[model samples]
Target: MISVLFAILTALSNGAASVLQRRAALAVPDTQTMRLSLIGHLLRQKVWLAGIGLVIVAAVCQAVALATGPISVVQPIFVIELPATLLLAGFVMRVRVPRGVWYGVAAVTVGLALGMASAAPGGGSTSVHGAVWVPALIVTGIFEAALITGAMSTRGNPRAALLGLAAACGYSLTAALMKDAMGRLDDGGVTALMTSWQLYATAAAGVGALFLLQNALQAGTLVAVQPMLTLGDALISILYGVTLFGEELRTGWWLLPELVALFLIALGCIELARSPLASGHAAPPRRSTRVT
Candidate 1:
């Protein structure tokens, strides 16, 4: 329950940050994208700075949630971030909420509820078993490398999908590492937690994921990036929870509802991503030299 609460807080904070960041991104020139100059352009805007603050808050909340609960329980909650982002965007833009967006929100909310109830995910170790880290890191590295390679060979939506998948993998890896790092606190102390290699690895993985996500967003439409990101993170996190942390979930008959729920969530994410407000395209593209 502690995990669930913090996870919700993290999702809401991240959703709010995304809306602020999108507004800032929309106000900037397209030429600045995928470049270091983009950060400089954004820093001039108060909205973007506020967004960065919220991002830090979300990261702290996420760390708390991962430390206290099973990864399966914590990660799936983030599926709501997309719907929340769009809703916040609509409000910020002073645009009326579209009927389709309402429907998508309902679908995602219901699907997430139904899925969590059906799966009843729980009972995972806080830390991975001994000697498992080596193989896990090796496989994850190879997988990310392959995705990045594929992304380089493609353009547009294809590239976005590949990069999104890679980002998903990175985020999942971060969560696993974070949990392991936090587990050290129980075993030793704060010093042990700070000294753990998992602590440093978690930061590295998070930065890598953020970088891939930025490129993915810039590569193509949100429709291509959002679904892969939404679903991929949930699925990959579940895999990590089960394989690395020994988390358990209902199987056999329960699989039916879980699959159905994932489909609904995916549909909702696609619909939400298609909205102009959600894509930060509702406002006309205006590149102003002065930001005030």
Candidate 2:
């Protein structure tokens, strides 16, 4: 129960932080590629640096939440930021969110809640099957490379979808690794992320995920990009739990809710497909906000 509470808090913070990052991104002048690179270049303007800093902070909060919670509880809530972000954009940023988008958000939210509620009840645990980190890192790297190559070759919104897929996979891997590392700890709440190969792998995965997501954002609208990323992350994390961690679905009849979740996910994706066309009218005009 405490874990779930922390997870929900983390999810809300993550959502707000993402909206801040997006707002900061909107204020920058460079093209998406250049903006991405420039974010790392401290010599540039404060907004770029601030955006990067805020994203890093948000990520840290997410990691802390995962350290304290079950992946089943944490991952689903983390995924909520996808739809919540769009809603925030609508209300806070003054972006015009579509009615379909709200419906999709509700469906995705309900589906995720149902899915989480249906996760097999247990105290959190993590175990690595083989080498602590080397193999997972290598495989995730290869996967990220393939995803990037595909994203580069693909056209338009499909490329965005592919990138979202890649980002979600990366995030799922990162979460799994983080949970595993956290389980290895005994005393201090903080594990030295540097000492843990799992953490390094997670960091590498995060780099690729962030870059891929940025590219996706460039290719599509915020409403579209965010929801697809969220859904993909949830799906991949669920697979990891079942296939990798040996977590079970709640009932003998688990297939039904799984199917329902898929249906809602598909409907959400359809709504997202129309988002790029809607962006010109959806994005809010630039407003001044301090980045502290």
Candidate 3:
């Protein structure tokens, strides 16, 4: 029960962070220019920086939640952020969200919930040393290089999707490294934070990833980019938790349900891609005139 509560809280925090980030992204109108200069403009925006700070806090909370809960339990709950972010955009931020996205949100939420409910619990805990973390970092670097190239080559939504996928992978691996560090922490919390270079590296990577994600969001629709970003992050994190952290299915009986849940998640992503919330300044209407 404690694990369930913490998982929900983590999901909520993540949802709020995504909403704020989206708002900040939408606030920046699209201007065709060199990518490096655009990034500089984004970095200078203090409101957006605050949104990034919120996401950082969410990531930290997620690390703490994973430290205490089974991966199966934690991963599914993270999916809640998808719906929460969309709803926040439509209702709180007063952005126009299409019906297709609402359907996608439904599919993702239900599928992830079913998957979590049916997933097998971890068999046992496992730990790894900091020295073994280098390869993961390299993989992340390669992934970012590929994503930036793709984003530069593609146009419109495709570029955003590619960038979001890259960000998702980076965020996933960073979380995995963070979990590894958490498992190895010493008694003194502050000392543990100071001594672990892996944690600091993971944090830096996450920040870089977020910068990419923000650029993607600014360049594409919320519906197309946000769901893809959230779904990819959830799936990758679960995969890492199981394969890297040694988490497992709760029972043999759960395999089918988990598969079904994943199917639902895929359907959800497709739905979200059909249409997304519009971003950019609303244009002024023409003045009324009498016929002559």
Give the winner by TM-score. Answer: 1
lDDT of each: 0.91, 0.65, 0.69
Which candidate gets the maximum lDDT versus the true structure? 1
Clashing pairs in 2: none
Of 2 and 3, the candidate ranking higher by TM-score: 2
Those runs of model 2 whose alpha carbons end farther than 4 Å from true positions after fitting are 25-57, 95-97, 121-124, 127-153, 187-194, 219-228, 269-292
> Global CA lDDT of candidate 1, please?
0.91
lDDT of 3 by residue, 1-292 (tens): 6656777777777667766666666566577255566666668777667768877777667777666765546665776766666666566566567777788888988897787778756643534544555665566578779888988998888888888888787777777766666765544465775687767777787787788888888777665576667667777777767666667766577788888987888788666545444333323345699999
Q: Model 3: which ten-residue window has the lowest total lDDT? A: 276-285
Which regions in candidate 3 have their CA more than 4 angstroms from the true location? 17-60, 93-102, 121-127, 150-153, 186-188, 218-224, 250-256, 270-292
Candidate 2 on 122-149: residue-level lDDT in tens? Answer: 4434645655346655776787688779
Models 1 onward score TM values of: 0.90, 0.74, 0.71
Number of the candidate with higher lDDT, 1 or 3: 1
Tens digits of lDDT, candidate 1, 40-106 = 9999999999999999999999989999999999999999998898889888877778899998999
Task: Rank candidates, lDDT, best first.
Answer: 1, 3, 2
* lDDT agreement of model 3 with the native: 0.69
Residue 38 Cα positional deviation in candidate 2, in Å, after optimal superposition? 7.0
Q: TM-score order of candidates, best first?
A: 1, 2, 3
